[model samples]
Target: MDYHLYPLGDQGVLIELGEDINLKVHERVKSVSAHLEKMNWDWVIEYVPAFASVAIHYDPMKVMEKEGDSSLYAYEIVCAYVEKELEKITPSHSEAPRTVEIPVCYGGEFGPDLAYVAESNDISEEKVIDLHVGGDYLVYMIGFAPGFPYIGGMPEEIATPRRKEPRLQISAGSVGIAGKQTGVYPIETPGGWQLIGQTPKALFRPENEIPSLLQAGDKINFKPITREEFDAYKEEEK
Candidate 1:
């Protein structure tokens, strides 16, 4: 219930709901964001919600114009309104998270770090795949790469830390794990997470109405597929 509001340069206001990254904090973050989006306040230009905070971008000129008392600053006006509004917002739990299934071809050439991950965990490659697929992860936020999801809910049994050395280039659709999190690489980019599999589905497409396949508050499940099936899925996309 405790929160803090801070200004970001001249255009953005960041709301910190809690100090730690947890489900309860995210719930508060999402609630505030949902309320902000609905209000569509004249000064608010955009909303960027993360695990424990939400950044609200606004027009400084518009905010200043609306405040009749020139003595009141832009950030002050925004902070007051946000604090008052948030006090009345009751977090909604009616909505069930949308689940998306991703098909992955594990090990071999597709996942260069698969062996390392298995050995590090003292588990067989098949067991590693099982643990990865068994998770029902929640999409906490999207960043790092376009449509790159930072997901949570991986079992502790399979938790693996990030690689000491990052790869110069990782292929799109590559699935990787770091610490207690798992995510898919939306595009070819340098990364340090341990690669476990690759998915054929495009996580980000500029032409699509919804450019990012995943969104915050959604859930994901990994499905293990054969190497041949992976090839077929890739071909079908063409």
Candidate 2:
């Protein structure tokens, strides 16, 4: 349970579980997050889990009242409590990661930059798709846009840089690659990732209890589908 605590402004504490973004670090992050969820801390507002850190946002007023110490600042009080709680957590206690299947239809209209990605990697378009599908991926975090998953573990062979000019509007479920990472645009938004395919599945469902289709620490499997299959999947949704 090696970690460092940093003051996030005055009301939040950033708990650094590890320095690098690896499975080991991710486990610690998840473990800490799960532990926090089980605890009934009245002063805790919310907790955000990231690549190697978990940020806990708390209520300064509540912390001051709970501590009943005029000498100790709110931040100091919260940090001490967090540090003690973190000491009790171990990676082994973390729940097993969930595996999610993301079916993608590569190339053609769905992927405008498919050719570019293939050329840049010096491989055929089909090979590019094969490499992408073959690789195991993990949802590192959801960010940039609602339900957008920042996935990692892309095969190095198919790795390519983001486009110099970003597209004004990328349709939701458009799968793209940026550098060594891959992600799906959850909402229609402007982005620079190289579009390689699109998924008929909806990643963002605001009406649901959990809005994001994916979350941090989930395992991802990319399954390739044909144009006909993609259209059929879309039809089923409606």
Candidate 3:
């Protein structure tokens, strides 16, 4: 992965950390985040982490006045910071990320595509749910939509391709996957991921201040529950 710095005007810099998304790319995000937090750059306002890059925000007007009109200058400063940190890559093994249990109702109406997924994998639908809930999924990043978490650890057997034709509107909490990544939508919106099942938990609640229930670096687990339980939880909330 060639890490090239892209200077955005005077205040913003984008670091191309990698070309692929994986556990290693995820590590880069964490490394960049940890480095920026320590530098406390006077010009940097925020560091937004994506799957393979970090976008550093800054005060454009202030930077322009002090550093002149060259975007390359800003790029160099940010590049140096990122490169220095990358070079001193002392592995700080994060604790098996904090796991959050999520209850899900599988098959029937709840998991409409269960049979399809099972058929595709030459396994029973019950086995599908078992494999899904069996292991903890790592939250790699949040993108595509707010509170929409990108997770890893989906069993390869049940891994299905996204629908050729996406639904016009998918309900919030719809758990879906595109290629190898599985994620849960926070709101009803257009998407192309293969729909699997849904969760009752509110992934995003605006009134909660920090609306997103999950954050990058968190671990997740699915607990298959009954339809009755799903309805009861929803009713209880109402």
Candidate 4:
């Protein structure tokens, strides 16, 4: 219910819901985003919801026309409209998040950092795998790479620090742990998170109606698979 609205240049406004990343903050952001989406206003171009903030991209000229004042500042006009809409929102009114399952082939060459993660945590490889899969994580935001999910709800037991020297090109579908969080790499990119596993699923598809397989406020469950099964899945895609 508590939030601050600030100008984000001449045609954008940022709504800060809170300082921390938690369900409460995310709920508020989702609610505001939903309401704004419903408006379908000409000025509103895109809505980018983050962990605790929503960045709204708008058309300054359209916003000024909508406000019926040519002299009105775009930021001021957009902020006023957003404030009015937000006043009616209740964070708890947001819809329930959908759940998705991601199958991963853990350890071995696909996950070079697996051994290091197990050793640093003082646990067996099997134990690390068990702990990692046992989690039901939440999708906080999608950023970094297209459709790359920033997830939460990782258990502390298997948490591992980022690599001291990041890899130049981590293969696509690599699942990794960074401090207290876990995520998947949707594309081949440089990263530092301790690699744990690789999934055969494609997290981003530009041709699909919904480009990103995951979105804000979704849940992900990691399922374990064998190397052979991983290879088979890849073959099926060919």
Candidate 5:
């Protein structure tokens, strides 16, 4: 219930639920986001949820029209409306979070930086994979690229820093470890995360009702698969 509201540019409001990135903060962010969605205000354009905050974009003209008072600024009207509605929201009453399983093909051609991660952690390549798969990961937020999940709860034993020089092109489905966090590249893009594996699953599906395969607050489980199995999975998708 504790939060702060700030103007995001001219037409948006940034709601700060908490200062840190933790389960409690994440819950509050999700709660506020859900509450806003249910409100369905005509002035609200869209709301984007992040680790500890939610950015809401609104239509200034619609807000002014709804208020029926041109004397007052649009941003002020929106802020007052948001403040009143947010007072009714709490971290409780949220629906159960969804769990997603990501199958990864580690090492070899798929993961060119597997050896580097193993060496960086002073562990064997197989141990790195074992620790990664054993982790209980959570999708905190989606950013950088569409459908790309910024995951948390990676095991400390296998943690590794990003590459010294980012690759020009990283194939879609490439799983990588950056610092203590682990994530999968949803689309073909350049990044510096330490490559460890590749998933056959498509994280970005533009044709679907929901384009992102993963969303914030979803639980993640990494499953290691063989090269043949990866190929078979990809074949099924076609």
Candidate 6:
């Protein structure tokens, strides 16, 4: 796998693996994470993984001291290790994606843009639902908003680009399309993605043990649920 490692904000290193958001890239994410954890690097505070890259945070003082250099030799040290370790991935370092289920209410009040999306794609609303729920999506990375999974695997026919005029406030659970991708809103935030169906599920709640509904490299399957079921879930929450 081709990769590029760069120094960022003193102790941070950004590693770009590839351009495509697919299973292959997701595997690379897991591989890199494991490799980093096993390495005896000095004072790595955090490792943030995204769609095509990994951003590593470290303590500059500790790293420089350990490497016996006044300059940023620590960055070079880590980069060398990463480049050496990422050699076609060994059998022991095989990547695996975790599967997650999200139940959604397709049309009417829940999906305000359902008709619009259907109209844009030249298909019936029912077909739109089928096309949407049919694919198994991958969580490339979480960005744009907290716990907002940057999901991939939308059908080519219904990959509607973001709205020319974005909504002022898209409520939590609002599922949307932006260019070639689709995702759900973890919190109410202004966004340009074409709003379609919604899931009653709590995408992010700090109270839960797992605060983030979707993590990077997660596999997602959208299951169509009834409005009544959604209402019941809300009622139960109350």
Q: Highest lDDT: give the candidate number.
A: 5
lDDT of 1 at 203: 97
Candidate 2 Cα lDDT to native: 0.90
Q: Which stretches of candidate 1 lie over 4 Å from their true place?
A: 68-70
Candidate 4 residue runs with Cα over 4 Å from true position: 68-71
Off by over 4 Å in 3: 1-3, 8-11, 64-91
Q: How many clashing pairs per prediction, in order?
A: 0, 0, 0, 0, 0, 0
Task: TM-score for candidate 5, please give it.
Answer: 0.97
* lDDT of every predicted structure (CA atoms): 0.88, 0.90, 0.78, 0.88, 0.91, 0.80
Q: How close is candidate 1 to the true structure, as a TM-score?
A: 0.94
- Quote the lDDT for 143 in model 2: 75
Candidate that scores best on TM-score: 5
TM-score of each: 0.94, 0.96, 0.84, 0.96, 0.97, 0.88
TM-score, cand. 4 = 0.96
RMSD of each: 1.5, 1.3, 3.0, 1.4, 1.1, 2.5
lDDT of 4 by residue, 1-238 (tens): 7889887887788999989998888788788888889988788899999989999999987877777745667787788788889899887743667999898999998888889989999998999899888887889899989999999988898888899999999898999999998999999999899998899999988889989999988989899999999999989976
The 10-residue segment of model 3 with minimum total lDDT is 88-97
In candidate 4, list every pair of residues with a backbone clash: none
Lowest lDDT 10-residue stretch of candidate 1:
21-30
After superposition, candidate 6 runs with Cα above 4 Å error = 38-42, 68-72, 80-96, 208-210
Off by over 4 Å in 2: none
How well is each residue in 8-99 modelled by candidate 6, as lDDT tens digits? 87778898877876667767776787677777675788888887788889886776667774454777776766678777454243445678
